[model samples]
Target: MSMLGVAAVIGVTIATFTTCGVGLAHGTGTWCALPLVWFIGFPLAITNALIVGLPLAFLFCKLRLTRWWQFAVTGFICATPVWMELAEPFTSVRWAQFGLYDSLNCFGSGLAGGLAYWWISQKVGIRRGTDEIAP
Candidate 1:
């Protein structure tokens, strides 16, 4: 696999660990939920990659949207209520139970996730075709 791809996986894994770890701590779950968090994280990450990450990728590729503010705003908007709303039905959770803060938490998490990805991509370099741009 490409180094960029590997870095994405590693970066997302770390982000998931920290985000979910803290989320479970604050949410209506226990340490016993850790396994489930990990279980849910990877798939949810794929959902985020598709639902949130894709547009960002498009902007990055087509529009060359590389600004930090662009990433943060785009990531927050896509990942906050939108990702949750879209992905919720696929998950077992009832939408009625979610409050405003849940979205805020998701926004924060998505913001961090995007930053994590950007930082990792910067460190590992971004791939465009078979060649990569060195950091």
Candidate 2:
């Protein structure tokens, strides 16, 4: 859970920097945008992690699918609903307004977050059976 939160922070940070880079390059006051983005993005990422990521993680562990790619794919999949909400494809008429760029942002967040969670879990020695004594 905590690792997921860390991942969320990482994802939000990456997406914010990427999205704000143009303004930053132009010397605009985009630095303030990070907090706002984090405010929105962090909760959303955490919610997704809890609502979607936890189940997927449990499934993966049960299935012995703990590979890095599997976690990455899980992250990408988990981020999909959030992307859909942000994109508003069904509610909006011209959905192209928030298309590829937004997608890349959200998906990138998911990927980064997922990988981060996996890395953190590994570093913390939280793998299945790691805590069990050898028979």
Which number leads on lDDT?
2
Highest TM-score: give the candidate number.
Answer: 2
lDDT of 2 by residue, 24-50 (tens): 565644343466675788899999898
lDDT of each: 0.54, 0.74
Error of 1 at 1 (Å): 10
- Writing each residue's lDDT as its tens digit, candidate 1 over 1-135 gives 232233334434554566556656779442333465446544565566675576567667565556556666665665655455644664445444444334444565566656665666666655434354456
What's the true lDDT of residue 127 in model 1? 48
Which 10 residues in a row give candidate 1 its minimum summed lDDT?
1-10
Candidate 2 accuracy as TM-score: 0.76
The number of clashing residue pairs in each candidate reads 0, 0
Error of model 2, residue 77, in angstroms: 1.0
Off by over 4 Å in 1: 1-32, 81-101, 127-135
State the weakest 10-residue window (summed lDDT) of model 2: 93-102
